[model samples]
Target: MSQQDRIPCFLLAAGRGERMRPLTDDLPKPLLKIQNKSLLEWHLGALRKAGIQDVVINHAWLGEKIEHALGNGSQFGLHIQYSPEGTALETAGGIAKALPLLKPEDYFMVINGDVFSPNLPINNILAKVAIFRAASNKPLAHLLMVPNPVQHPEGDFFLEDSQISALNLGAGEKLTFSGIGLYHKDLFKDLAIGVPAKLAPLLIAAMEQNKVSGEKYVGPWHDVGTPQRLQELNAAYE
Candidate 1:
């Protein structure tokens, strides 16, 4: 697959940023700057580098700031759309609400807006989607699993042989869900649009059926959850 091949993606931007406090009291967390650049901008820049042409961003808390900051993403060389959840619809609900706008043929990419990963492997992910699409049974989702972060050491799911399971398989590595994944529309099929729903329950259900697959990504990725974490990232950039 080449740059010309267009695959739409949506960034999970709809969140309250409750943890970021006073800084986020005025600005959405994703708008918080790292080296004077908003977190969402990094995702956009990387997506542009990966040749993704279309994008969607969902926002709830102070969402207009997000829109004003990024505009239609023309500056990033990509057409952007927004899914304004009157309130943060958690994850699956936000995706479900945006489903109409996405209408992904098979799978579409989603990345947590809070995570600061300037070098997102979009092409590699698309390649994996190709393989998943060609397999005997298409997985409902493909996740990018990163080593357990200090904030979340227990990890979220188990990865054994490229397959993600909610249950511990005894030998598989239990890693963190990098908040990056390619999901089939069907994964949110039962969810009603506008109703708040979390992605974990849906993913857990899918994992039970062995419908989720993932791969380890030992790269520069960080969950900018706390102000200290953001400060550390900026300090490192300096």
Candidate 2:
């Protein structure tokens, strides 16, 4: 991608992490480590490798720690910006808050700060961006789905013919959202700036209009939500 077309990325890190308790009480979840590397750093390394230079990280609880840890992102080979929501806005709201900082691109990548997916493919994401850029009818959102882990066996959405649809009365093999996605800015444009909002409703609304698409990603992905899950991931990844 040319410098003129280099798409920016938004890192979703503003969650209060209620599930991850005391560990998050002192540190924002995104700053937590897996195999000695902070989650945000792992993501930064991959994003930089993917040739995405600009990243906006939104944080609420102990937000300053994230800024202190990563600084201006010079060490990560990228320019960084922070969206410090004083109180954690839910997913969509956080992205909406950072939209301006994401540059003027119509599309930007969004990744969940807490998920551990070190092997997410960079080239695949770039290819999808290319496809979206050239499509006559670009999807409002495209997600990378994963086979449901034991903890979330029922899963989130069903993937059929490269389109993502909500479970139809609980039928079909459901896949877990990898929490990594490419989204058209229009998807979140209507969300109120400061109100807390979840992303599911927005994506579901888009899916109802055949505006969302996705692919299954079979990779090492973990949603490190609980202390046990975190411990298991540390031992397993170690």
Candidate 3:
């Protein structure tokens, strides 16, 4: 598929960032700066480079600041839209709420706005989406898995030969979810709009049926959940 035909993407920015404390006390976590640019800006630049045009950002806390900073996304060569929530809905809830804006495509990409991944393998994931849709056993989601960070040592899921499962399946390597995924619209069909729901339950349910897929990404990736990590990221870039 051509770049223009690539799927739309959603940047999940609605979280309250309670972990970031005083920093998030004023600005939304996605708006936090790394290498002098906002976290969301980095993702937007990467998305544009990956040939994605339409973008949706969901925000709750200090959402106006996000709108003010990015505006219509013209500067970054993207057409941006916002899905504002009265309160921060969990992952699946936010995606469900933004479905209308993302309905143009059968599958859409979602990335946690707070995470910092310089090379997210967007094209590779898109290629996987095409393969998934063609298979008889259509998967509801394709996730990007990374090495578990110190903060999350147990990790989240296991991958064996491209098939992801909640179980270890004996010896497959376990990895932490990178907070980035390509999801089919049908995945959220049963979810009620504006309802608070965590994404893990949905993913785990699909995993039990062998309906979720994943790939390991061994490149630079960071969750950036704390002030120290933020400073560390900035220093690394410098």
Best model number under TM-score = 3
Per-model TM values vs. the true structure: 0.96, 0.95, 0.97
TM-score comparison, 2 vs 3, better candidate: 3
Backbone clash pairs in model 2 (N, Cα, C under 3 Å; residues 3+ apart or in different chains), count: 0
Best by lDDT: 3
Q: How accurate is candidate 1 locally (lDDT)?
A: 0.89
RMSD of 3: 1.5
What do the candidate models score in CA lDDT, each in turn?
0.89, 0.88, 0.91
Decide which is better by lDDT, 1 or 3. 3
Query: After aligning candidate 2 to the native by TM-score, how far in Å is the CA of 110 from where it should be?
Result: 0.3
Model 3 alpha-carbon miss at residue 163, Å: 1.0
lDDT of 1 by residue, 1-238 (tens): 4433457899998788888998899888899999999999999999889878889999988999999999998899989999998878889999999988876887889999999987778789988767877888889999999999999999988999999998887678999999999998899999888999999989989988889999999989999999999999999987
Off by over 4 Å in 3: 1-4
Residue 146 accuracy (lDDT) in model 1 = 97
lDDT of 1 at 3: 39
Colliding pairs, model 3: none
RMSD of each: 1.7, 1.7, 1.5
